[model samples]
Target: MTDTVLVTYGTTNGSTAQIAEAVADILRKDGLTVESRPARSVTGVAPYGAVVVGGALYAGRWHKDARRFVRRHRVELAERPVWFFSSGPLDASAAERDIPPVRGVQRTMVRLDVREHVTFGGRLEEGAKGRMAGMILRSGKGGDFRDFGAIEAWAHRIAEALAHT
Candidate 1:
């Protein structure tokens, strides 16, 4: 029987949600029963055979709900296969390539023994149009720098790892 997988994500400007959906799709194709839900919507982790948690980075912080979910479910999560992903960075500029402050949460999760964590560049959507975004965009500073090929390859790797466990 296929294992149940839960992909819970927190998104502010929408890129993280899209990335989570892509990961879920890849898991489903691998014959896992997958459900993609917003982080706030998640009630419990017990139903899932494996959990994949993801969040967006904003101003050097992860979405609050993502942090809470992990904190609340840390014990259950530690007993199972878990993976983490963060959707951040806009392009190949020095700022994007450099580690952002919001990345610290991944290290915290690693301490809890999450099996894997991956970072991927996010998108700049309409709602993300803010003073900072505008300044960045006006400066012609960033572009949609997400690497779909790499994302897919990572998803495949996650699937392969899960299959063996």
Candidate 2:
């Protein structure tokens, strides 16, 4: 039998969406039916056998829509299997990974008891398409540093969990 998997995410520069698609591809390869969509497009979680939610982080936070989806479907999510991922914290350039104060969607996910969560490095375009992100980028912070290997490994873990349960 095939499983219905919903992979949803919120992205600023679209890196998170790329990550989500990669995850969905992994699941699809496992013989499951996967649908990838933006978090804002999701109306309900009732139709999915499993839910994978992810979003890019801005200023130490997950996107609002991703968090809101979990909040709106908390009851259903709790009853089913849900996995979460965040795209944030560009390369440390050193050994230290210091996460700032908890804020936004991440905080909301914690309250909802999501089964698993992962964080991947995000990228920022140095140009001036948007001022807020550009400011952060210009601050000498960093750029896209997502580890595709780690992402695939995490997706496989979720697949295993769903397979056994």
Candidate 3:
């Protein structure tokens, strides 16, 4: 069986992509083959033994491309091990907020029997384009808040799970 794992993500300003790459790197370090791609660019999932899908969160919802990817691949994903992640939350406190998964994602999770969903802290660059994001950035709260240690720990856990599977 192919041991390749697919790490795909959706991002508006690239923070989510960075997180996805970090996860992929950790998995690769554990001796697994990893392929990383943007959600919209991924054509199929059959070649992968496991799938890790991630997206940037906005207004309590996942990026549209990521959501669409889940909807399109729910069946194949159900047949394999699947994990989901959202990259949002401006700070540690935001990361601790008890935000519920968006309805679409929740439905997809049930359909795919997803193993886990992790939400990581996000970054907001000052010159980001969106009006809402721009306004938030003006408030001087925007900066990289990603917890790399936590992200690596989660990836290691995934690697362990894959080893047993």
Candidate 4:
């Protein structure tokens, strides 16, 4: 029987949501069942064999909803395979650094025995809806920095790991 994986994320400007959807598509293409949803909307992880939790990173922290989701579903997540991803760091150099998860996220990562945590380059569009986000985007470092090929490669790795598990 095929196992279902849940790819849930919290996105500020929708870039992270796109990444989550890309992940779900890759998993599905690899013959696994997948569900992609926003972090705040996911009520439970009980139905999934594996879970991928992601969020937009701002000021070196994950979005609040993603952090809360992990905290609220700590026990259930601990009982299954869980992976975490942070989509941010518009600066290319920043993406190369091994950025650590925020304090609250760190605690939950420990509790859940998170399989992996990836930091991907993010997109920042000028004049976006968010106030601070717009200010940042206007700083002359905004463009589509997302590396789709890298994202797909990572998703393939996840698919391989899930297949073995």
Candidate 5:
């Protein structure tokens, strides 16, 4: 509870990482200390006052690393404010509507009492790994659909909530 926030994510092609960075940057600009890192790399959550976990959606589920992170830190995370995000839906749908978290993610949210959960548009670019990604690209279904404005706005809300707390 030192007013430091940890923004961590599991990304397959790096888009989720970028979103985490954006969230961390906004928190920093709002006068809070923040760290952004990969979900699997974090050893513990003892040093953070709040946590933001994000994952890339794949085949209707959250990234495995993200799920593992939550399971590993559930005890510590339950004592602090926590937020979750999922980056998927390679369309504008995420931006146009509030996409509910996948079933597993929803379960985690309830278990952790997460402050909020968001579903952001995902990015599948030309060099994304995996045969499915290549197929999506060839089928012309890959593109960047994340809305920075919405992301910043969400981060700002987090900052505001933290300040009040």
Candidate 6:
């Protein structure tokens, strides 16, 4: 496989997309060719040597697009290195500890023999889409809780792992 990596994500208010871009940036800096794209827009995974798929959480489940991306590309992904991340939890919990992957993500990881998985803090702010987002904002729970330092560190780990492979 070539040293090309695909970083893709499913996002609601665009926060998860930002996280994916950050990961792609780090991978690129590590001298890997990287491509960042929305999960819904990717048609195939065959061209990538490695893949990082991230999803935004909503009510304890992954975004529809991320779930669909995994399901559709399961075959191709199994043949290469794959990592998964979830961005949700508008709190500092993710930064403070190792947030375990939800059931669906866990199952996918096991089935695909995924390299690793992580749960990063999420972001919710004004102008977010969806009724639940508006409700959360009204309840004063909306905020940016993503920790870029942790995200970059994780990407560095991925880059290191890629180097050995």
Q: Rate the local accuracy (lDDT) of all candidates.
A: 0.78, 0.77, 0.88, 0.85, 0.94, 0.94
| Model 6 misplaced stretches (Cα beyond 4 Å) | none
Of 4 and 5, the candidate ahead on lDDT is 5
Judging by lDDT, tell me the better candidate of 1 and 6. 6
lDDT of 4: 0.85
Q: Clashes in candidate 2: how many?
A: 1
- The better candidate by TM-score, 2 or 5, is 5
Which portions of model 3 show Cα errors greater than 4 Å? Answer: 94-100
Instruction: Write candidate 3's Cα lDDT for 105-151 as tens digits.
Output: 77888888999888888899877769989888988879998989888
Which residue pairs in candidate 6 collide?
none
lDDT of 4 at 131: 74
Question: lDDT per residue, candidate 2, 1-165, as tens digits?
Answer: 326989999886788899999999998887788999999999988889889999777666678877677777888887677888888676752114534324555565666667877677777766625677777777977576877887788888888888887
Candidate 5 regions exceeding 4 Å error are none
Please list the Cα RMSD from the true structure of every candidate, rounded to 1 decimal place: 2.8, 2.8, 1.7, 1.7, 0.9, 0.9
Count: clashes, candidate 3: 0
How well does each candidate superpose onto the true structure, as a TM-score? 0.86, 0.85, 0.93, 0.92, 0.98, 0.98
Can you give the lDDT of residue 76 in candidate 2? 86
Q: Model 4, which residues run further than 4 Å from truth? A: 94-98
Q: TM-score for model 5?
A: 0.98
Give the range of the ten consecutive residues with the poorest summed lDDT in model 2: 93-102
Q: For residues 54-116, what per-residue lDDT tens digits would candidate 1 score against the true structure?
A: 987777777777888888888888888888887777775422454433556866666678777
Candidate 6 structure lDDT: 0.94
lDDT of 4 by residue, 92-118 (tens): 743456667766667778877998887
For 80-111, candidate 5 gives per-residue lDDT tens digits of 99999999999999999999999999999999
